[model samples]
Target: MHDPRVLLDPATDAVRKLARRGYDLDLDALEKLFSRRTATVSATDDARAESNRAAKEVGAAAKRGEDVTAARERARELKARIGELEEQQRALAAELDEFLIGIPNLPSDELPDGSTDDDARLVDTWGEPPAFDFEPADHVDLGERMGILDLARGTKLSGPRFAVLRGAGARLERGLAQYLLETHTERHGYTEFSVPAIVNRPTMTGTGQLPKFEADLFRTGVADRELFLIPTAEVPITNLHAGETLRAEDLPFAYTGHTQCFRSEAGSYGKDTRGLIRQHQFAKVELVRFCLPEQAAEELEVLRGHAETVLRELELAYRVVTLAAGDTGFSARYTYDLEVWLPGQGRYREISSVSDFGTFQARRAGIRTKAKDGTKGFANTLNGSGLPIGRTLVAILEQHQRADGSVRVPEALVPYVRFERINPDGTTS
Candidate 1:
């Protein structure tokens, strides 16, 4: 949530930045709420203190054998007034919390002062799309022809946006996740973790996925009030330090984990509905980090490099794009989306998105570190999908497909799958 001080600090220049991100902060409304709250608290406190003094006076009068009836009446009146004011104060405090919780995070200074997709910049491509003699088929057609994916039965078994990866298709998805986790942990510096797929609402909201994207999530029907299936490992992994303080030496924490992410696809109708591109459930390997504010820029570059390495080693063509302020995720100040070249689709599609959230999430989660002077504030956060296992599987099948209907697996994945090619007949070539 945005800091109220953003509106008060003139030197911070948050108004123009907030305007760029589509936020019209109502400083006046907040001031009114706070004013009422303060008045209510003061009235209640004054009444209680007056009542105590009056009671003491009445007791001393009785001790002196004097009349105490007038003092007793005054104390009774103060007690009644304090009770009424207490209720008003509680209500006003609740309203303030509601307003604060729903507000969006402040954008970083480096974020372009704009609110549109056109503001985005094309960074560059890592590799070029491969040339094909024949018109390449999309993932749905390619997987179906190879007998590795069954879309019709998958929908029948569950519903639309769900898939059944048979034979080599299943192996490919597993191999993709393994490759990503290994790259992040072995080659890069990240702690590998296995976390719960279902978590509480606080965990979801902490990662900036709840209170807005709730419709896109699949909540557990049996216990919807207590748990929601995590949309990404980013939810649980990034929130590990919630409600805690870390030492300065423990700065720049990085972690990697793989899990099946569930989405309801609430608003996306008839978009990438045919194949693994858009699924109700898909597997992904996630990377998350907590770092100092000054370290966020460098951390973003390092994490981006880790995600790009997966495609590079697999020899898949890909490019990176910097998301505009308006196009970036809710918790992120900046983002870099890795788009892999799909020969079949004839265009690059996003396979991974690396983001630097700055201190947006950390503030919400209360994850912080004490400064040398003993003051504390939110920690900066960063996360990315090393790569989506389901989508990467689709890209590999379509990109490495041979004219004879055999799929040449990436050389890096041969050892994991125990073969280099998956023939059309569901046999190793």
Candidate 2:
């Protein structure tokens, strides 16, 4: 959420910047809401003052030994009026809050033009897509041939878009997750955390995943409690400091976590419906950071580099692209998506997204930074997928597979998996 003071100020260029994301922020309608709220607040204050005066008048009449019935009755009337005004004030406040929460973070003025992924600006590319003498098979065909992935069983158990990894495929997913967690925590200076896969409504909203994206979430509850399955570790990991204040000395905090993410993939019909490219549930290693507003720019690059480190270590060919305003996530002011080259798909697919949310998420989550002099302000937040395990596994299988149908493990992950390669027979060798 944004600061109401800045958003409501007529002089601010908020409307223009928000337009970059293709969002039409109705300043006139918002002004009316703001004016109404202000009037309601003023009325409440006036009624409170009048009630106080009425109480004093009744007290004086009682002290003078005069009949205080009418005075006391007037006081009671004032009390009732104040109650009505206060209720209005509360209702108006809630209305304003809901309106503000629906608005997305303002896109940075420096962002490239346009709103969709096709309009994103390409930053750089790394390595090269591998050459294959034989026609490259997609992850699904390769996994099935190796007797590792079972899609039919997955569908039978939970319907379409679900996958069951067996034998080497399951091991590969686990190995990839472990390798990513290790690389991030040990070398990237990130503190590893084990977070819950389930979070409450506030926790979900704290990261800007609620209300707007509820349709894409898996909601569950027992009795009267409302809970949601996290779509990514980013949701839980970034909210670790929600409603907390940290000293300026603790300027930047880096955290990493691995979690099983669930998504309804709402409205995504007939898209990547095959294989591990899109799934109802998948594992991912996430990275999150909190820093002073001034440090956000540098933090973004550093965080992106940490995610890139995983790809570099695994020798995966990938490219980085800066997302346009509309393509960026709700809480992110700017984003960099790392698309790994998949020879099987004959194109680059997103495997990680590094974003700098400025103070957008911090304001929503109530994470503040207290300066040495005692002044405080919201902290800036950023997060990225170090790598989504399913996609990474897909890239590995397709990129490193031999013409003979065996898949060679990347050198960096060999130690973790305790094998150099997975044979065509689904045996480790």
Candidate 3:
């Protein structure tokens, strides 16, 4: 959420910074709202002062043995006025809050100025897309032939865009998630957490997923409370410290979680409906970080490197791209998308996104940290998919498929899978 003062003061640098985000600022509307809010506040203050003065007058009149009826009547009138003003004040405050929460975070000045994914700038590439001896098969063809992925049955049970992993496919998915969690916890210094998949409205709102993107969420009614299936582990893991204050020593808190993410995919109708590329339910290993304000920029790079390490360890080819200002997520000031090379599709697809939210989420979440000098401020928050298991599995099957229909397990996941390769006959070799 932006500081309300920035929207009110057009001449401030913060306002200018917001202008660079390529959105038309309705300064006149904002000013009108600001004026109404200020007027109510001023009226409330005046009423409060008048009520106080009237009470004193009643007391003085009684002490002087004068008739206090008129003073008491005036006091009652002032009290009623104050009550009405207070009600107006509350309504105006709610209106301002709604306006503030709807505004997206200002894009970082370093971000590219375009408005679409095509405008994103490529920052780095690792490894090369594997050369195939024969025409590579997409994950759907490979999984169906191996009796692993059952899209037909998935559609029977649920509907389109749902999938079921059988036998080796299921194990492979689990193994990949285990590898990612272990790598993040044991090597990357992130504390692993198993959080609840169902969260409340405030929890979702804390991460900027509610109110704005409600259509993309799976919401349910649990007794009297409304709950939502987490779209990402970032939602719960990041909100672990919501409405709390941490010490300066805990400036940089890192956490990792593996969870089943459920998305409604409301806006996407006919895109990537085949295979695991776009699914209603998917598994993801999420990484979240909270740090001091000045450390956010550097922390984002470190977080991105951690995600990149996963692809490097698996020997998967991928590229890092800086998302353009308009393409960035609502809560992110800047984002880096890691697109893995898929031989089956003959192109790259996004497997992970690392973002630095720069206190935008912390402010919404009421998460704060106390400084060494006793001053308190909102902490900067960041999160990334260390890797999503479904896409990683898609990459593995396509990249490691042999001419004989066997899939070679990456060296990093061999121990977890207890085998080096999965044969078409459902046997491990």
Candidate 4:
């Protein structure tokens, strides 16, 4: 959420910035809402003041031994008027809040202009795509042949877009999650957390996942309490400090968590349906940070590098791209998508997205920072998929597979999975 005053101020370029993201800011509508709220507030205050004055007049009239009937009647009328105005004030404030919450964050001015993924600006490319001596099999073929992935059974149990990893595939998924968590916590200086897979409404909204993207989420209920399956660990981990203020000395908080994420895949009916590329449930390790607003840009770079470290360690070929305004996430001012090369798909697929929300989430979540002088302001929030287990596993299988159908595990993962290769017979050796 944004400060309505700043967004409504004519002198600010909030509207123009929002336009870059394809969000048409209805300033007139917003301004009118703000005006109505302000007027209601002012009227409420005036009525309360009159009520107080009338009460005082009644007291004085009683002390002077006067009838005091008129004074009491005046007080009663004022009190009723104050109640009416206060109700209007509450309604208008809620109306204005809903309006502000619906607005997307303004895109960074330095972003490359575009409206789609094709217009994304390529920032860097890593190792070259591996050359194959034979036709490469996609993860679906490789996993099915090895009896590791069972999508047919997954659909039987749940529905389409669900997956069941067995044997080596399941082990690899666990190993990747451990590797990611250990790397981020031990080497990247992040505090590891075990967050809940189910969260409440405010927790989801704190990270900009509710109200706007509810259709893309899975919902549940416990008795009368409504709950949501977290789309990403970012939601629960980043909101760990929601509605709290931290000391300036602790200006930056890096949190890493592994969770089984769930998403409804609402609008994506037919895309990436063949494999784990798009799934209803997947394992992911998420990285979240909270820092002073001025530190956001630099922190974003550091966060992006941290995500890249996973690909580097896994020896996967990948590229970093600055997403166009139109392609950026709802709460992010700037984003860098790390796309890993997949030989099977013959293209790079987005494996992770590191985003800098620049206090957009902080304001909404009520995450604040307090300086030494006792000044307080919103803290900037940022997060990235340190690595998604499913996609990373897919890349590993496709990139390291031999013509004989055996898959070589990345050297780094050998220690965790206890083997260097997944044999064609579904045995690790």
Candidate 5:
């Protein structure tokens, strides 16, 4: 939720800055509510004063032994009127609060404004998309040919947007996550944690996934009142500081966790329907950070590098892009997405989205920090996919396909997978 004070702040300069962030602030509605609240408060004060004065008059009248009943009655009426106004004040405040919750955060001035993909900038490209002498096949086609992906049975069991990863597809997904987790914890300085895939509503809402994106999530209909399957580990990890205050020294706390995210995919009807790109369930190793406001942008670069390092290790080609304002996630003020090249599809696809939320999420979640000077303020939050395992698997199969029809496993994951090639016969070819 945006700070309500900014909506009502009397300073002209402050409002202009707010305007730059694309916030109109509903100043008229705010003014109307403030006027009502102030008037009610003033009326309540007057009522209480009048009641006190009446009681004093009654006491005087009683001392004089006449007209005491009329004065006492007047005080009772004033007290009842004060109670009524107080109730109205509570109602008005509640209404204002509901309105505040619906307003989106103002986009930062640095944000690129456009509804389409134009404002997004591809900042870096790594390795080279392997040039194939023979024609390359898409992941769906390669998976089908190699007996790795089974979409038919996935549909028979779980309906659309689900998959059955057979043989190497399943193994590769697990290998991808393990490889990403170890790389970050062992080399990237993130604390590895195992978090609950089913989390309560507050946990979801705190990370800015709920209320706004609830239709995209799967909630438990029983047991916990408002529990929902986490859409990503980012939700749980980012909420680590929700409703808590951290010390300044804890400025840049990084956490990485793996989760099997569940999504309804209600709006994405037909896009990416062929392969592992879009699914009802997918495993991802998410990276989250709690950093000082000044350090957040720099943290994003380091965070994005952590994701790119996996592709680098796998010897996969990829590029990083800064997402435009309209194309970025709800909670992200600025984002850099890493897309891995898929030779099969003849195009690059997103595997990781590294974002800086600034104080947007921190303010909403009440995630804050106590400064060295003892001043308390919200911490800037950042999160990115260390990598989504399914997409990485897709990229691996598509990018490394050979003319003989077997897919070459990346050198980095071969040890964990215990093989260098995925043959159609379910053996190293």
Candidate 6:
């Protein structure tokens, strides 16, 4: 959330900055609202002082044995006026908070000025797409042929945009998640955690998933309480220290978690309707970090590398792209998406996204840090999918698929999978 004071500062160019992220600021109305809020606050303060003065006069009159009724009546009137002003101030503050929270984070000045994924700037490419002699099959066809993926049964049980992995497919998904968690914890220095999949409304809002993106969430009621299934482990992991102030020595905190994520895909109708590319329930290894504001830029790059390591270990070809201003996520000031090559689709698809929230989420979640000088400020928060298990599995299946329909397991995952290859006959060799 942006500081409301930014809107009041003409030098900050807050309105123009927010416009770059596709947010239209009603400056005229916002100015008027701020003015009214200011005026109401001043009036409330004055009324409070006047009430106190009037009460003091009544007390002095009573002590002097003089007529105190008139002074008491004046005090009562002043108290009532103060109450009214206080109510108005509360309403104004609420309105201001609503407006501020609805606004998306300001885009970084370095972002390219454009509106879609096409505008994303390519940062780097790793490895090369494998050459295939025979016509390659998409994961949907390969998994179904191997009796691993059951999309038809999934639809019958839940509806469209759902899938079930059986046999090697299920094991592969589990292996990928375990491999990611182990790599992040052991090699990347991330503390591993197991988090809940259901979170309350405040927890969702802390990670910028609530209030604005509620439509993309799966909500349920437990008795009289409303809860939401986490759209990503990022939600739970990032909120772990919400509303806490850490010491300056703990400027940087790293955490990783693996969990099942749920998303409604509300506005995304008829898009990627097949396979594991998009699903209602998917598994992912999430990465989250909390650091001082000054360290955010470097932290984001390091975080991206951690995610890219998964692709490298799996020997997958991939590219990194920095999202354009308009394409960045709501809470992120800047983002880099890792798109892995899927030979089956003959194109690159997003497998993970690393983002620097730059105090935007910290402000909302009340996460702060205290400096040695005793000064306090909001901490910068960052998170990314170390890799979504489904998409990583998708890449592995399509990239390593043999002409005979067998798939070679990546050496890194061989220990966890205990298989060299998944044969066409659904047997491991």
Best prediction by TM-score: 4
Clashes of 6: 0
* Residue-wise C-alpha lDDT for candidate 1, range 149-228, written one tens digit per residue: 99898899998888898888888877777777777888798999999999888888888887878898887745446789
- 163, model 2: CA deviation in Å? 0.9
The window of 10 residues in a row where model 4 has the poorest summed lDDT is: 7-16
Model 6: how far residue 167 lies from native, Å: 1.1
**What does candidate 4 score in Cα RMSD to the true structure?**
1.1
lDDT of 3 by residue, 1-429 (tens): 777776566564555556666666666777778789999999899889888988998898899999999889989988898888889889998887888887888788889878787999999999989998888899999999998899999999999989999989999999999999999999999999999999999999999998899999999977899999999999999999999998867778999999999999999988898899999999999999999989998999999999999999998999999998878998998999999999888999999999999989999999999978998989999999999999999999999899988899999999888889989866777
lDDT agreement with native, every candidate? 0.83, 0.90, 0.90, 0.92, 0.82, 0.91
Compose the digit string of candidate 4's lDDT tens values, residues 1-429: 999899877777998999998999999998899999899888888888888888888898899899998888888888888889888888888988898899999899878888888989999999999999899999999999999999999999999999999999999999999999999999999999998999999999888997999999999989999999999999999888999988978878999999999999999998999989999999999999989988988999999999998899898999999999888889999999999999989999999999999989989999988999999899999999989999999999998999999999998998889999999978989
Candidate 6, which ten residues in sequence have the lowest lDDT sum?
1-10
Per-prediction tally of clashes: 0, 0, 0, 0, 0, 0
Off by over 4 Å in 6: none
Query: Scored by Cα lDDT, where does model 1 land?
Result: 0.83
lDDT minimum window of 10 residues, candidate 5: 12-21
Candidate 6 lDDT over residue span 1-429, tens digit each: 778677668987877887888898888888888899999999998888888888888888899999988888888889889888988999999998888888888889899888898999999999999999999999999999999999999999999988988999888988888899899999999999999999999899888887999999999979999999999999989899889998877779999999999999999988999899999999999999999989998999999999988899999999999999988999999999999999888999999999999999989998989999999999999999998999999999999999999999999999988888999977888
Residue 229 local lDDT, model 6: 98
Better of 1 and 6 by lDDT: 6
CA RMSD for every model?
2.7, 1.6, 1.6, 1.1, 3.6, 1.2
User: What is the descending TM-score order?
Assistant: 4, 6, 3, 2, 1, 5
Q: Model 5, residue 341: displacement in angstroms?
A: 1.3
Q: Which regions of candidate 1 deviate over 4 angstroms?
A: 12-15, 38-83, 112-118, 221-224
Between the candidate structures 1 and 2, which one is better when assessed by lDDT? 2
Would you estimate the TM-scores of all the predictions? 0.90, 0.96, 0.96, 0.98, 0.87, 0.97
Clashing residue pairs in candidate 1, if any?
none
